[model samples]
Target: MTLPLPRQRRTLGRTGLQVSPIGLGCSGFWGHRRFAEGAAGRVLATALEQGVNLLDTGHNYSGFNAEPRLGRLLAPLLATCPREQLVISSKGGTLTGQAGLGGTEQRDFSPAAITASCEASLRNLRLEYLDIYQLHGIGEHQITDELLGTLQRLRERGLFRHLGINTHSRGTLDWLAANPTVFDVVLLDYNLLQQDRAAHVAQLHEAGMGVLAGTVLAQGHLLPYRPRLPALSDAWYLARAWLKPSSRRLMRSASKMRRAVASIASQAPAQTAFAYVLQHPGIAAGIVGTTRTESLLQILATDPCLLDAADRARLVAVFGDGRGSPSV
Candidate 1:
């Protein structure tokens, strides 16, 4: 099937890289038990064909299944697309074992382990250099001289063009952003519920570092709170959370918020969530993970400009304006 390409492209902060406003986050490409390889490849091919240049993945996602699956799709594309035409980003720091399922993961940021991780990734990806190489999930203490020196050495060897950090911690993100010379990009979880990092994202962008928003869908909490589309991850989470009253309350609150967003935007809750993240002025790209082409197409079809002055105000009122009220 022929798909229309997205016309929008934004600068990835000061990296001088231009990418589609929305990039495919590939953590669940084949890591999620629900995603098959053929479907994952189709979604990827569709995204790339539509001018979405940024592809985000990590070594530990899907228990090490994610990167190799991505590499398989990319290998064929490399035959036609020039290496520089695509912006591939991958992270490391966590090591997985046995199968792609969780349970036996361990953190290893030692210089030797990091070096080995990059070399292994290169072999898996069948590529000479990555566009963006990030430190997976490191705390401030992990930012030692040894780690920084190792990243620099990797860069000098042409292993990657730019350095970035993908952290769940706002303090680490802020610290790295403050030291702009060490990192070129920042990827963090930012959604309505986790707006604590929103201002930091804008701050980093202003400091001339690319900021990519992850978990924009709030781990599917922002997806349409409907019955037919239950998520496997959500089900597993809810099973554990259901036992606790506080977790139940949080789930109920999230459901109400989703419904409210749908009513306010006169759009599907998922579409509204995608629109919300893409409209952020400082966000270079909002990374979305999907296993199906239909889901990807829906996101690609969303017009970031769909939200107007009043819609923006309503969203801010509903979700709070901690991330600023700039329209995209």
Candidate 2:
């Protein structure tokens, strides 16, 4: 039997912003290929029309073009949807305009760089202030008193309402857990194949900071094997996928999960993957960033997807935190 999904919103930490269970990630990194304006705009329109109000983007997404693109598309939507109703969160700290296709992003969380990036993002999005502004992919060391002071000054200046951070590091989460006052939101990488940080997610929640799971789809790697791309997209995604060693181990064990999962009859693997993430405790929403509208539709189709205790335990036995078999 098909279960109905919830249409409610969850509190985004102490910021008091209510967001949908599915947030649209505007990274524009689909295979590192060019995303046409028409298609991108269509994705944005369809998402909003379908009740998705959270748009997650960053300063360097799509080589520094995602923000402006979103700006142009959002202008028309604002005519109907109140700006406050849509929670637009963006990240900076990653250096923009760097050469190369899907190469490493140089992070610049320095006060000067962050200040400039936030200001430029405000200008690009054509907004007075962002709902949430994050420091993209920085370590705990970067989260110093000076950085706090810098963000405080910017927040005081009305650049943004809440502070956020985007990271895949558990250590970073631990640091934030020790000092949850540092940020109001966290964009984390958690998916069926990468579940090691589940506990830390709860910690952030306990500390009153919202957690948005990024890469919930694992860059589409969690799906069964598919044919190679004709271009560099596959190469880029594969290379970056190795960055998460645990995921690498999980990929080795993926064939086991590729088999039929119990209780979920005839459902798509994409939906199952999404369900596992959203159902995880303390996860506000799962962020999906695909250029294809169909992919987003599939994810939304499973809004508040269900995975009972048996399903959860079975997933752990299979994925095992994406780490190899338990140590002896």
Candidate 2 C-alpha lDDT tens digits along 83-142 = 787889998898854324444467878899999999999999989899999988789887
TM-score of each: 0.86, 0.87
Question: What are the per-model C-alpha RMSD values against the true structure?
Answer: 4.6, 4.5
- Model 1, residue 312: distance off in Å is 2.2
**Could you tell me which 10 consecutive residues in candidate 2 have the lowest summed lDDT?**
319-328
Q: Among all windows of ten consecutive residues in candidate 1, which has the lowest summed lDDT? A: 96-105
lDDT of each: 0.74, 0.76
Over 1-328, each residue of candidate 1 has an lDDT whose tens digit, in order, gives: 2233468779998788888888988775345545667877888888887778888888777667778888888887787667777788998888753222322246789999999998888877788988999998788778999898998999999999999998777669768767876789988877665554667878888889999988777666666645677756556544534553333433554655565567754555667777777778889988988766777888777776776768766766665633321211
Residue-pair clashes per candidate: 0, 0
Model 1 residue 266 lDDT score: 50
